[model samples]
Target: MNKDVLTFGVEEEFFVVDRDGHLSPAGDAVVDAADEEEGELQQELTRSQAESATGICTARDEAERQLTALRTDLAEAAARRGCRLLPSGSAPLAETVLPAITPNPRYERMSEHFGATARTSHTCGCHVHIAVPDRETGIRVIDHVRPFLPALLTVTANSAICDGYDTGYASWRYQQWNRWPSAGAPPLFGSLDHYESIVDAWLRAGAILDRAMVYWDVRLSEKQPTVEFRLGDVAATVGDAVLYGVLIRGLVGTILASEARPPKLSNEVLRAQIWRASREGLSGRCPHFRTGDLAPASEVLDDVVTFAAGALAETGDLDFVRDGCARLAAEGGGADRQRARFEKRRAAEDVVDLLAVRPARD
Candidate 1:
């Protein structure tokens, strides 16, 4: 595989809030402001949310720079409209009205099909897109990387609160998202043809209306020539997002280099692993994909990092990833930070405030 295959991009969704720190349906205003400034922003399923995507980047530092610029520009644009931007996984405060759907035909069809799930779903997430040599490599990447995705979610956990109360789970957004018809881990496919056949079967069976509804944690991008990872929450800072991008590219590179095939785990076990990761985050044990043995989440994460060390080093991202992981473990992840703020102030709004800013580094 060409080393350039490691090129990647990130997309992050954000919540739009009013001055009172409550979810607000101001996505249009913010998007218009962003458009005037030539920012790469778009409306989401709900009018209360917006998303931004970074251009293709080859280095971790370049990815971080693009993400930081997007976050800063979007926040400033939202502020100009008297609405605040919160890069939180879920809305912090309760909302009385359903957010309006984005004015597009496909989103309209999605709303009609999913009903309340579309209107009430205000969760945000960060998706990583990594380049591959071809369709075969993309299929191979998604298959081989499936087992490790749960542990990746443990690191990006961020939604600890919802509707002014603690949800008790580290990433409530994952739980909410799992409610979709085809939203969990995908089954292993032997070839790119097999993958497309399964997708075709789903569409014909009405399990999904279109290709876009195939919401597996990882999938071949229908719109691009890359494998898309849709597992993690929107990171709380640019650094965290960059860390995720680096680690994903490293994992992909490692898998491609080894020329390994995916192991067959029952769908039941895969779903169980995903749920456990979301529920406990990094505070509990994670089930090892190969051994089926449980270990502390931190230890499991360390093993993952160690497994990809060579790839990370080759990309010149080893030191940054090592330091970033250490910092996350020490200072706590987004969910920990949100819970700490709520615990200290006894107010969910303060958590929203903290989510709005780039968290102070330890």
Candidate 2:
């Protein structure tokens, strides 16, 4: 297997809502569709929503092709029933509380464990999975990729806006996740064994249900031969998701290709910075993981993009990175856009209607 070559798969969460905009449990709908291979690409998780996953693809076009089809089927199904499938990292309405069951045993159990930690809104997230050749390679990738997680999050913080409110944070989903124990950044690990050792401690601590439930912003998957990045908020369109997909692959590849110099951090301080980034998004300061210095979030992103040039160039995605950053600057990213829309429309319905505009993938 080529250790240096990396590929990705995308799994996006979508809100399944009824005509009244009430959240619906769609785990059975999604999983059953997967079973028939006929509808929404199946995902195993909590139901008031559904997931559209991709077949492993070597290129962005292929990933988009699969994602588009999957979301279309799911959206059409929901629309047929006078419902809408919306992608958000978390539900925008803090008061819109719903049951968490998804009809899957894994989800049922996982929810029981983390439900206490999750927020009440219905938010969706874009989880990008990168291939890991085997156990050893997987461990190495996890060990080396910690510090860069913030740079990755800042570049893709689409949840800056959700529902009709600004929520005063960039990626509110991270802020939501921080409510649960064992759901934030992990301490830098020196080796796979060391990583697992921490997992073992969590298992023994009874704080986590399994190694798979560790919920790090970036974590090695327990079942898949890959790393799962859970940081990004659900992007509003396929273009946004793909743009992010390209950047994630580049970041991970850059880390894996190097001499394995682990990006170090002091957990307590770093965790505090993580909260600030989650709360402020790009508007406030972010922790510089490497130098442990304070800098504007934009400054932090500028440097990370520079460090990521080689990988982005090799993947033919450097332009996407540069352009995505420029677009964020011009548009103020998701949070800014969300706030502007709310200010203009003065209504959540209009805000969502605007977000529902499906951008053509051309």
- lDDT against the true structure, per candidate, is 0.83, 0.69
Q: List the residue pairs that clash in candidate 1.
A: none
**What is the lDDT for 173 in model 2?**
73
Error of 2 at 52 (Å): 1.4
Cα-lDDT of candidate 2:
0.69
User: lDDT of candidate 1 vs native?
Assistant: 0.83
Task: Give per-model TM-scores.
Answer: 0.95, 0.87
Q: Which candidate is the best by lDDT?
A: 1
Q: lDDT tens string, model 2, 72-135? A: 7677666655566766665554335564666567666766666654325345778898997886
Give the TM-score comparing model 2 with the true structure, all chains together. Answer: 0.87
30: Cα error in model 2, Å? 5.7
Error of 2 at 118 (Å): 5.7
The worst-scoring run of ten residues by lDDT in candidate 2 lies at 31-40
Per-residue lDDT over 1-362 for candidate 1, one digit per residue giving the tens place of the 0 to 100 score = 33664788999999888878887778867877863232278888888888999888888777777787787777878877788779888888877877788788888998998888777777999999998879898888887887897789988889988888999888899988877887878888769899899889989887788998888999989888999999899988888888888899899989989966588877788888888888877777777756767887777888888989989889988888889888887888888888989998779989987888431221
